[model samples]
Target: MHTHHQLIAEKSVIDTIVLSLPFILIITIYLTAVFISNKKYQRWPFYRIIFFIVGILCTAAALIGPIAESAHTNFQAHMVMHLLLGMLGPLLISLSAPMTLVLRNLSIKHARMLSKLLKSAYVQFICHPITAAILNIGGLWVLYTTDLFSMMHSSILVYTVVHLHIILAGYVFTISMIYIDPTPHRTSFYLRACILVIAMAGHNILSKWIYANPPAGVGKADAELGGMMMYYAGDAIDLVIVVILCYQFFKGNSYWTKKAHSLS
Candidate 1:
């Protein structure tokens, strides 16, 4: 039995490394691209590179290490992974302006092709604040409210799909809320703000629900602790998004106001 347990542990370690390899390669490729871009154009901000690295590291830490291993058995650790993967990681990556960097590095023809892709109707619809909010908050609702959470633990493919959805939904929601990257289908500020508020409320309410009605197979105490972590940590990250949005809104207004005064 001890030998069997040791083999299981070793296999888990191997699986973790195997799962993490793709993400590590992605980060390496991104950093290499950024480095090449900086060399080509001295104007690439060093801070953006730092943000990208930090964002990738946050994602890696959540998905590839002890935290990820614990998350399978510990609700609190799962909440931490959710925050890192779904909120902080997405926000930091958005701030990195990766699309902008890619556009800068691409040839004009390729850049135009990318721009055209961004303008596609499907991209436009999904990038809408309302749609993004639904996918982001609504996804969490489905996962926790249904048997999906428990189901995910039983299937590695489902688990990967869910995590991928979390990251992608979070990224789309973050970009919709804030104009960090080139948004060909930009929604009005008021509309985006309204969606953001509704999404945040939904997220918080779900946390509270989980507190009272724990997910399948989760202990009440563990659920409560996880719920609290999700609530507080999510708010902390969302606050950053709120601040950036408000700053951009006010700064744009201020700039236009100054222009009006000058014209008068």
Candidate 2:
């Protein structure tokens, strides 16, 4: 019993240190980039810097501190962590336009190379709305339905990989749906809107499934609460995405229409 407690303690310490490293690194790099970029070119948007910081805090809140510790055994806490890590964090970070900031900071040659990479076939494929949806929503379905949830709790490596996937998949999914950054391969607003609806439906369905059939180790009560949170909260964030996409679509159309009228 003593040995087990000691092992748990050791793991907790390790998790704290390991998890903190990334957030610290991200903040440092981001601030440095912003500073250098502002000095060289037009000052970077102050609000975007705040967005990036808040996004980092949201992700950090999910990964570190008491909430993260509770998440291992508490399904409700885990769901909250999921919302922060995968949805809200990604949304705010996407709004920050970090890639655009980076492009502005980089030398012309490097920026061109980065832009070229963005235009590459692999980038285009992964950034497609359909593919992003599969990676994001499909992955959640697999995790909650299979033994993966239990395995993630048991194994540190699995936990790390799952969290990384959640963050990256969510970010990719958001960017795929909305054009906050310089998209080299653009899709029509109609297609993106359709894909967003399908993806959100998949998410809603998965939450309902979790409520009906709890994950391996999670209890029914916890599952119900988490499912509800996932449903309503997820919808709220998704609604924001919908509103932004619609606004941008109509705004762009308006500009084009006026341009056409002037030409005529």
Which candidate gets the maximum TM-score versus the true structure?
1
TM-score of each model, paired residue for residue: 0.93, 0.93
Question: What's the CA RMSD of model 2 in angstroms?
Answer: 2.9
lDDT of 1 by residue, 1-264 (tens): 569889989998899889888777877877788878877886677788788888988899889889998999999999999999999999999999999988978999999999999999999999999999999999999999999999999999999999999999999999999998899899888998898889989999999999999999999999999999999999999989999999999999999999999999
Alpha-carbon deviation at 153 in model 2, angstroms: 0.8
Clashes of each: 0, 0
- Cα RMSD (Å) between model 1 and the true structure? 2.1
In candidate 1, what residue range of length 10 has the lowest lDDT sum?
38-47
What range of 10 consecutive residues in model 2 has the weakest lDDT sum?
Answer: 37-46
Cα misplacement distance, residue 187 of candidate 1 (Å)? 1.2
Per-residue CA lDDT of model 2 for 61-144, tens digit only, reads 998988888999999999999999999999999999999988988899999999999999999999999899999999999999
